[model samples]
Target: MACVTGKNSKPKSMSKAKEWTVEVENLFRFQQAGYRDELEYIQVKQGALIERWPDTGYVKKLQRRDDTFFYYSRKRECQDFEVHKVKVYAY
Candidate 1:
Protein backbone atom coordinates (compact mmCIF):
# COMPACT_ATOMS: atom_id res chain seq x y z
CA MET A 1 0.00 0.00 0.00
CA ALA A 2 1.12 3.59 -0.71
CA CYS A 3 1.21 6.22 1.98
CA VAL A 4 -1.07 9.25 1.62
CA THR A 5 -0.73 12.77 3.01
CA GLY A 6 -3.33 14.42 5.22
CA LYS A 7 -4.86 17.92 5.04
CA ASN A 8 -2.79 18.97 8.09
CA SER A 9 0.51 18.65 6.25
CA LYS A 10 3.09 21.42 6.86
CA PRO A 11 2.65 24.51 4.76
CA LYS A 12 4.73 24.83 1.60
CA SER A 13 7.89 26.91 1.75
CA MET A 14 8.50 30.10 -0.24
CA SER A 15 11.76 28.59 -1.53
CA LYS A 16 9.91 27.52 -4.67
CA ALA A 17 9.63 31.23 -5.52
CA LYS A 18 12.56 31.31 -7.92
CA GLU A 19 11.15 33.59 -10.60
CA TRP A 20 10.70 37.23 -9.68
CA THR A 21 9.47 40.24 -11.61
CA VAL A 22 11.43 43.40 -10.92
CA GLU A 23 9.53 46.49 -11.88
CA VAL A 24 11.62 49.45 -13.04
CA GLU A 25 9.42 51.99 -11.28
CA ASN A 26 9.79 50.22 -7.94
CA LEU A 27 13.56 50.35 -8.33
CA PHE A 28 13.22 54.07 -8.94
CA ARG A 29 11.28 54.41 -5.71
CA PHE A 30 13.96 52.46 -3.85
CA GLN A 31 16.64 54.71 -5.31
CA GLN A 32 14.74 57.77 -4.16
CA ALA A 33 14.58 56.24 -0.70
CA GLY A 34 18.44 56.29 -0.58
CA TYR A 35 19.16 52.84 -2.04
CA ARG A 36 22.02 53.69 -4.39
CA ASP A 37 23.29 51.63 -7.31
CA GLU A 38 24.99 52.77 -10.46
CA LEU A 39 22.55 50.70 -12.47
CA GLU A 40 19.58 52.28 -10.74
CA TYR A 41 19.06 55.86 -11.76
CA ILE A 42 16.26 58.28 -12.54
CA GLN A 43 16.39 59.78 -15.98
CA VAL A 44 16.34 63.57 -15.73
CA LYS A 45 14.21 63.86 -18.84
CA GLN A 46 12.12 60.72 -18.54
CA GLY A 47 11.85 60.68 -14.77
CA ALA A 48 11.74 56.88 -14.98
CA LEU A 49 14.03 54.16 -13.68
CA ILE A 50 16.69 53.04 -16.12
CA GLU A 51 17.20 49.27 -15.95
CA ARG A 52 19.36 48.52 -19.01
CA TRP A 53 20.57 49.91 -22.31
CA PRO A 54 21.31 53.67 -22.35
CA ASP A 55 22.09 53.00 -18.68
CA THR A 56 25.26 50.92 -18.87
CA GLY A 57 26.88 51.45 -15.47
CA TYR A 58 24.04 50.07 -13.37
CA VAL A 59 23.26 47.29 -15.84
CA LYS A 60 26.89 46.14 -15.73
CA LYS A 61 26.78 45.87 -11.95
CA LEU A 62 23.50 43.92 -12.12
CA GLN A 63 25.20 41.45 -14.45
CA ARG A 64 27.86 40.86 -11.77
CA ARG A 65 25.29 40.05 -9.02
CA ASP A 66 25.90 43.42 -7.40
CA ASP A 67 22.48 44.98 -7.75
CA THR A 68 20.34 46.21 -4.86
CA PHE A 69 16.78 44.93 -4.91
CA PHE A 70 14.03 45.79 -2.49
CA TYR A 71 11.10 43.76 -1.15
CA TYR A 72 7.98 44.32 0.91
CA SER A 73 8.01 43.02 4.47
CA ARG A 74 4.53 41.59 4.46
CA LYS A 75 2.61 39.45 2.02
CA ARG A 76 -0.77 40.64 0.76
CA GLU A 77 -3.78 38.57 -0.19
CA CYS A 78 -5.29 38.72 -3.65
CA GLN A 79 -8.20 40.85 -2.43
CA ASP A 80 -5.83 43.25 -0.68
CA PHE A 81 -3.66 43.85 -3.69
CA GLU A 82 -3.53 47.39 -5.07
CA VAL A 83 -2.27 48.77 -8.36
CA HIS A 84 0.00 51.80 -8.49
CA LYS A 85 0.65 53.87 -11.55
CA VAL A 86 3.66 56.07 -12.26
CA LYS A 87 4.03 58.61 -15.01
CA VAL A 88 7.37 59.45 -16.58
CA TYR A 89 8.12 62.29 -18.93
CA ALA A 90 10.17 61.51 -22.02
CA TYR A 91 12.18 63.71 -24.36
Candidate 2:
Protein backbone atom coordinates (compact mmCIF):
# COMPACT_ATOMS: atom_id res chain seq x y z
CA MET A 1 0.00 0.00 0.00
CA ALA A 2 1.07 3.55 -0.68
CA CYS A 3 0.03 6.87 0.78
CA VAL A 4 -0.84 9.64 -1.64
CA THR A 5 -1.60 13.22 -0.77
CA GLY A 6 -4.62 14.86 -2.34
CA LYS A 7 -5.10 18.50 -3.32
CA ASN A 8 -6.35 19.26 0.18
CA SER A 9 -3.10 18.02 1.63
CA LYS A 10 -4.82 15.05 3.13
CA PRO A 11 -3.59 11.51 2.98
CA LYS A 12 -5.48 9.29 0.60
CA SER A 13 -5.66 5.50 0.60
CA MET A 14 -4.17 4.05 -2.50
CA SER A 15 -2.84 0.73 -3.57
CA LYS A 16 0.72 0.55 -4.76
CA ALA A 17 1.66 -0.41 -8.25
CA LYS A 18 1.27 -4.11 -8.75
CA GLU A 19 4.55 -5.86 -9.30
CA TRP A 20 4.64 -8.99 -11.40
CA THR A 21 7.18 -11.71 -11.72
CA VAL A 22 8.04 -12.63 -15.31
CA GLU A 23 9.04 -16.07 -16.43
CA VAL A 24 10.07 -17.50 -19.79
CA GLU A 25 8.58 -20.91 -20.33
CA ASN A 26 10.64 -21.87 -23.36
CA LEU A 27 13.46 -20.30 -25.34
CA PHE A 28 14.77 -21.92 -28.49
CA ARG A 29 17.96 -20.79 -30.14
CA PHE A 30 18.71 -21.67 -33.73
CA GLN A 31 22.15 -21.20 -35.11
CA GLN A 32 22.47 -20.05 -38.72
CA ALA A 33 18.72 -20.11 -38.97
CA GLY A 34 18.47 -16.60 -40.37
CA TYR A 35 20.35 -14.77 -43.11
CA ARG A 36 23.77 -15.48 -41.67
CA ASP A 37 22.34 -14.48 -38.32
CA GLU A 38 21.18 -16.35 -35.28
CA LEU A 39 17.52 -16.74 -34.51
CA GLU A 40 15.65 -17.25 -31.28
CA TYR A 41 12.19 -18.42 -30.29
CA ILE A 42 10.81 -17.00 -27.08
CA GLN A 43 7.66 -18.28 -25.45
CA VAL A 44 6.55 -16.67 -22.28
CA LYS A 45 3.88 -17.62 -19.83
CA GLN A 46 0.37 -16.43 -20.55
CA GLY A 47 -0.64 -13.32 -18.62
CA ALA A 48 2.81 -12.70 -17.27
CA LEU A 49 3.10 -9.10 -18.34
CA ILE A 50 0.54 -6.71 -16.93
CA GLU A 51 -0.74 -3.68 -18.81
CA ARG A 52 -1.42 -0.63 -16.66
CA TRP A 53 -2.55 1.93 -19.19
CA PRO A 54 -4.69 1.89 -22.32
CA ASP A 55 -5.19 -1.88 -22.01
CA THR A 56 -4.52 -4.77 -19.71
CA GLY A 57 -3.38 -8.23 -20.70
CA TYR A 58 -0.47 -10.61 -20.83
CA VAL A 59 2.18 -11.28 -23.48
CA LYS A 60 1.73 -14.77 -24.80
CA LYS A 61 4.58 -15.25 -27.22
CA LEU A 62 7.01 -13.63 -29.64
CA GLN A 63 7.47 -14.35 -33.31
CA ARG A 64 10.64 -13.86 -35.28
CA ARG A 65 11.26 -13.98 -39.02
CA ASP A 66 14.53 -13.01 -40.62
CA ASP A 67 15.62 -9.83 -38.86
CA THR A 68 12.19 -8.72 -37.85
CA PHE A 69 10.62 -9.89 -34.64
CA PHE A 70 7.08 -9.21 -33.47
CA TYR A 71 6.50 -8.77 -29.76
CA TYR A 72 3.36 -8.17 -27.72
CA SER A 73 3.40 -6.28 -24.46
CA ARG A 74 0.85 -5.09 -21.95
CA LYS A 75 2.61 -1.89 -21.21
CA ARG A 76 1.96 1.07 -23.45
CA GLU A 77 5.19 2.96 -22.84
CA CYS A 78 8.81 2.04 -22.47
CA GLN A 79 10.63 3.32 -19.47
CA ASP A 80 13.83 1.28 -19.11
CA PHE A 81 15.04 -1.93 -20.67
CA GLU A 82 16.74 -4.62 -18.67
CA VAL A 83 16.69 -8.33 -17.96
CA HIS A 84 15.97 -9.98 -14.65
CA LYS A 85 15.70 -13.45 -13.23
CA VAL A 86 13.61 -16.01 -15.12
CA LYS A 87 11.62 -18.82 -13.60
CA VAL A 88 9.51 -21.52 -15.19
CA TYR A 89 5.81 -21.16 -14.48
CA ALA A 90 3.44 -24.03 -15.00
CA TYR A 91 0.40 -23.21 -17.09
Candidate 3:
Protein backbone atom coordinates (compact mmCIF):
# COMPACT_ATOMS: atom_id res chain seq x y z
CA MET A 1 0.00 0.00 0.00
CA ALA A 2 1.16 3.49 -0.77
CA CYS A 3 1.75 5.90 2.06
CA VAL A 4 -0.91 8.61 1.89
CA THR A 5 -0.87 12.02 3.54
CA GLY A 6 -4.46 12.81 2.66
CA LYS A 7 -4.40 15.90 0.46
CA ASN A 8 -0.63 15.73 0.08
CA SER A 9 -0.01 18.64 2.37
CA LYS A 10 3.34 18.62 4.09
CA PRO A 11 3.73 18.78 7.81
CA LYS A 12 3.77 22.39 9.00
CA SER A 13 6.79 21.54 11.11
CA MET A 14 8.79 18.49 12.08
CA SER A 15 11.29 17.68 14.77
CA LYS A 16 13.22 14.72 16.08
CA ALA A 17 11.76 13.51 19.34
CA LYS A 18 14.08 14.17 22.27
CA GLU A 19 12.29 11.96 24.76
CA TRP A 20 10.36 8.70 24.71
CA THR A 21 6.73 9.18 25.64
CA VAL A 22 3.68 7.06 24.86
CA GLU A 23 2.89 9.34 21.92
CA VAL A 24 6.43 9.07 20.58
CA GLU A 25 6.37 5.33 20.95
CA ASN A 26 3.14 5.09 18.97
CA LEU A 27 4.52 7.42 16.33
CA PHE A 28 7.54 5.18 16.02
CA ARG A 29 5.29 2.23 15.33
CA PHE A 30 3.24 4.21 12.83
CA GLN A 31 6.36 5.31 11.00
CA GLN A 32 7.58 1.74 10.89
CA ALA A 33 4.29 0.83 9.27
CA GLY A 34 4.87 3.41 6.49
CA TYR A 35 2.58 6.07 7.91
CA ARG A 36 3.52 9.60 8.88
CA ASP A 37 1.55 9.34 12.11
CA GLU A 38 -1.58 7.88 13.65
CA LEU A 39 -3.82 10.43 11.93
CA GLU A 40 -2.43 9.38 8.60
CA TYR A 41 -2.77 5.75 9.50
CA ILE A 42 -6.41 6.21 10.33
CA GLN A 43 -6.99 8.14 7.16
CA VAL A 44 -5.19 5.58 5.03
CA LYS A 45 -6.67 2.57 6.75
CA GLN A 46 -10.10 4.20 7.09
CA GLY A 47 -10.32 3.97 10.84
CA ALA A 48 -9.03 0.44 11.31
CA LEU A 49 -8.62 -0.48 14.92
CA ILE A 50 -5.15 -0.32 16.43
CA GLU A 51 -4.49 -2.97 19.02
CA ARG A 52 -2.89 -1.68 22.20
CA TRP A 53 -1.96 -2.91 25.63
CA PRO A 54 -4.97 -2.25 27.82
CA ASP A 55 -3.10 -1.33 30.99
CA THR A 56 -0.13 0.62 29.64
CA GLY A 57 -1.91 1.68 26.42
CA TYR A 58 1.18 1.11 24.36
CA VAL A 59 0.96 -0.08 20.79
CA LYS A 60 0.87 -3.85 20.63
CA LYS A 61 0.53 -4.50 16.92
CA LEU A 62 0.58 -2.80 13.51
CA GLN A 63 -0.20 -3.88 9.99
CA ARG A 64 2.43 -3.04 7.40
CA ARG A 65 1.98 -1.89 3.80
CA ASP A 66 2.63 -5.36 2.44
CA ASP A 67 -0.19 -6.82 4.56
CA THR A 68 2.26 -8.18 7.12
CA PHE A 69 2.15 -7.56 10.85
CA PHE A 70 4.56 -5.96 13.31
CA TYR A 71 4.27 -6.64 17.00
CA TYR A 72 5.71 -4.45 19.75
CA SER A 73 6.43 -5.20 23.36
CA ARG A 74 4.46 -3.83 26.30
CA LYS A 75 7.61 -2.29 27.70
CA ARG A 76 9.28 0.68 26.05
CA GLU A 77 10.50 -0.12 22.58
CA CYS A 78 12.07 3.23 21.71
CA GLN A 79 15.52 3.09 23.26
CA ASP A 80 17.51 6.17 24.28
CA PHE A 81 19.58 6.29 21.12
CA GLU A 82 16.56 5.55 18.99
CA VAL A 83 14.53 8.41 20.50
CA HIS A 84 16.24 10.79 18.10
CA LYS A 85 14.98 8.72 15.19
CA VAL A 86 11.33 9.28 16.00
CA LYS A 87 9.92 12.27 14.21
CA VAL A 88 7.19 14.59 15.51
CA TYR A 89 5.18 16.10 12.71
CA ALA A 90 2.84 19.06 13.02
CA TYR A 91 0.31 19.94 10.42
| Residue lDDT tens for model 3, 22-71 | 88988988898898887776777777899999988987988887889999
In model 2, the clashing pairs are none
How do the candidates rank by TM-score, highest first? 3, 1, 2
- In model 1, what lDDT does residue 27 have? 35
Q: List, residue by residue over 6-61, the lDDT tens digit for candidate 2.
A: 32232223222223322221111111122111111212222223222243433333
Model 2 Cα shift for residue 43 (angstroms): 16
**Winner by lDDT:** 3
Output the number of the TM-score-best candidate: 3
The TM-score of candidate 3 is: 0.84
Runs off by more than 4 Å, candidate 3: 1-10
Task: Write model 1 residue lDDT over 1-91, tens digit each, in one string.
Answer: 0122542233232121122223333333343444332222332222344344333222311222244553332222112122122222211
Per-residue lDDT, model 3, residue 69, is 90
Candidates' C-alpha lDDT:
0.29, 0.25, 0.82
